[model samples]
Target: MLINVCNLNNNHELSTTEMNGQFVQSQLQIASLLKMETTSTDQKEFICKCRELYKDNKTQLHFVDEFER
Candidate 1:
């Protein structure tokens, strides 16, 4: 058995915000970060936000697949 994982953020240009708010290694996928949705209000919890200009569709999905646990 084998598994593959990729850090999509490794390729793009990192901005000051993404650099500071980076929640994972190096940074996050420009698209994945842009599409993140949260309702938290605290500034300290301001994570998963992109450049606010990232419009890529790579991480966009229609439905979340649920698995039986």
Candidate 2:
């Protein structure tokens, strides 16, 4: 249900869904970006960091994920 974009530039692109021509804009759902088809390197690193930070929790991510689904 999501559209993918392919850009060849260092600058952040504008969101087509909102702020049509805005730059440096970020979506509110950064944590779930890892599952996104267009996730950037920074988003992957941020997700990795979040995983490490809460990795010690007994419930664990996998369990939470399955439960969420």
- Best candidate (score: TM-score): 2
Candidate 2, residues 3-40: lDDT per residue as tens digits? 23433363445455544333223333343564667547
Number of clashing pairs per prediction, in order: 0, 0
lDDT of each: 0.39, 0.50
Writing each residue's lDDT as its tens digit, candidate 1 over 1-69 gives 112234356536877566566545334554565577745452323222321222353442111111111
TM-scores for every predicted model: 0.21, 0.29
Clashes of 2: 0
Error of 2 at 8 (Å): 44
Model 2 vs. true fold: TM: 0.29
Task: Please state the error at residue 4 of candidate 2 in Å.
Answer: 32
